[model samples]
Target: MSSRSMLLALAAVLLQTPALTQAFQDDLLQQCGTTTVFSNHRQGRLRQSGVSRVVGGIPSPEGSSPWMVSLQLLHPGMGYVGHICGGVLIHQSWVVTAAHCIKNEKYALPISHLWSVQFGPELKRFAIKEIVIHEMFAGYNHDIALVQLSNPAPYVPVCLPKSGQGFQGIRCVASGWSTTSAAPTTLTRRMGIPGPRAHVHLSVVSSSVCRNRYLSAYNITLNAGHLCAAGKGLLTSGTCLGDSGGPLQCNMADGRWYLAGITAFGSGCGRPGYPDVYTRLAYYLPWIKVQIKKHESAEKSGNYL
Candidate 1:
């Protein structure tokens, strides 16, 4: 079969399989609260070894471009552990990701280690000067954060949608190596170890539908600043355990990619009914700007306080 035909056939198989959706969702949702999504090891006592940060490295884009980018975080002793989180390269040195993915922690590593940035789906390394979390995002209200690399990425990063722009029912793809494991059968504090296979999938969902389902649970009030997307069918295919901090990118009429959301939470990976939730990046631009300014000021003064 031709490559195009092969891709179509594969997509058909993916959209038709409820089990695949369930598997994807289960992995991503299982990752919440298990330390930052960038950290590769499972929750519990932090591991001295293993890929420690982010979900997994970015995979190659097969077509024009996959609507996803890579995220890497600092891990102690392990060097920089890469994971898949959805993000848009907004500027030369800055990219946006979910605050929950790297929030609360002032440094990417534990203040005792170094962190680096890797861009595109290829997992190349770059030096990251600092990570700036939205000041207003104390817990979850505004769950967006930014990473400023020491240099620009080689690949063209996606840009943020203009303020007030909106999208629905767009064919979007988020790529990441998701953990392949279900939540422990029982409700216990401990979680199962996610398998090593890195995974990625495609889905198309509406903003209103996602808001109606997730707003109450995540405590978000959608507005011009917030953009949303979701998957349809009996099961929604999405980013899973290793897919946190990734982007939900949608295409626009002008043919440029616009970042619509950042993976935040979901009722589960691909439950038949529940929709995945993401932190609305545009909603918290003011906070993001403030953070950038703070970092700049600190740099100018030679102090980070």
Candidate 2:
């Protein structure tokens, strides 16, 4: 059998092995070459195919709102490489994304690699001032981190969900130029090549269901404090690359979108029978607040500070 098949089968077996939890984690790291990149050379073919649609309440703003930001990784030799992960425009200056997206050396994209934050849905860009990853976050903990923009973005801030807010049943929306399917289908099949593909999607999902069902496959650490959002339809709606570091907002009391989660992981791009996962923003508010304070303080101290 192929290595991918072996690992899947192993994962299936370990699902039943209580003693194997450590073993499973080790195997996942070893077999998958577990970096923040989360690549399985064999599984790359599984990511293609997700569908897209417009966000409901938020209409297009004239000349771009200050709210949205696209986090791009810039390598000195490579120029601007776009969207290593998704993030949200919480404050005019600070953006939030998964720590794993900006973590340690294993799959770490260098801090110097970050070039800019492009705002607006059409993706016009701007340079960033600094990236402050949380000091305590080990990245494996999959905590939150921030990217400070050089200038304030013009969009409005979305509502922040309370810390520890479970997305168990909430219907929420995620927006980004993430991944959307070019077409839709019912069957789950893996295709395409082994590198990254762009094109993004926005979708709604059920957190509770996704956490219970695909947690093992998707590298979910529920206690680590992330949220999950299942897709609304089969092969119809969800996130893709370039959609990283974006918002998962819920339709709230005032009919405005409340920031519920940040896009995280999923089995595939709106793959049939699966949900898109997001980082529970409610769980990370303190971290966001702290990071923003540091950035703000730095700005006050000196331009480089």
Candidate 3:
């Protein structure tokens, strides 16, 4: 072929690359939001009669929450990483978490190298390649972050919400792994097997109702990016576990669990009558997509922050 013809062919291929990539990305996510291990019977029973085991929740089942990711920090003295927060797997190599989990507090940077994510029922670990914090994040204003794992985890990812999916009054479950039953007390940590995890039941509260609750109780106004959720049980108790960045998942009518939000923050490790806050995933899905697309190649290329 002539040089001009060859150049035209190359340009055509280049123009199609992004569209092809997008198609593949969509296909991959299409296979997500499900796991062969999730039992419909077990979840039904739990929903019917789940007792307050950890504060106002019960321990998670082994096959449950296949997309839950435990964020761990390396302990300099202990020489091992332990669960510090929680995250939800959105894609094979991407996780969604609360920005406050790794926010820069003069102690830990948002893009710190010490952070990693542990997932799967076997509890395998993966190194964090890149962290994308919301650019407008400031004191929980935009309290969500996207995490890029160094390699794709061979695990099923939780489904993102359909465009404009509303979550108010929806009964959801928030799952998190912790060493103790309540606020961190003297407890021995475990490894190489399933650790104690809590599956707290919560009901999504409307933004206005949540705002009023916070204002009347704490005398503070909340950001619109946050989701307010009241705890499940008598009197609608809030979560007391205090595991940040955990998933606030709701089981949709299709018998599939969709990731609604991540644990953002709560005052005093949560208490009765108040609703807990979460980084509404639906509100920030666009930001999440842009960050993930922009950084999808970062893991394979040169170093980036």
Predicted model with the maximum TM-score: 3
| Deviation from native of the Cα of residue 280 in model 1, angstroms | 2.0
- Clash pairs for candidate 3: none
Best by lDDT: 3
How would you order the candidates by TM-score, starting with the best?
Answer: 3, 2, 1
- List the candidate 1 regions with Cα displacement exceeding 4 Å: 1-69, 77-87, 104-113, 120-122, 178-212, 215-227, 289-305
**What TM-score would each prediction reach against the true structure?**
0.59, 0.61, 0.75
2 or 3: which has the higher lDDT? 3
State the lDDT of candidate 3 residue by residue for 11-93, as single tens digits. 34323322225456566677666654333322211111111112334656676777887776654444333565678889977
Better of 1 and 3 by TM-score: 3
> Which tens-of-lDDT digit does each residue in 19-136 have in candidate 1?
2243453443333112112212222100101322223323322432332444544345543334424455565446677666664453433121143444433434555567666656
Model 2 lDDT per residue over 140-202, tens place: 355667776655554455556666665555555455542323432321112111111222223
- Model 1: residue 212 alpha-carbon error in angstroms: 4.4
Superposed Cα RMSD, model 1: 15.6
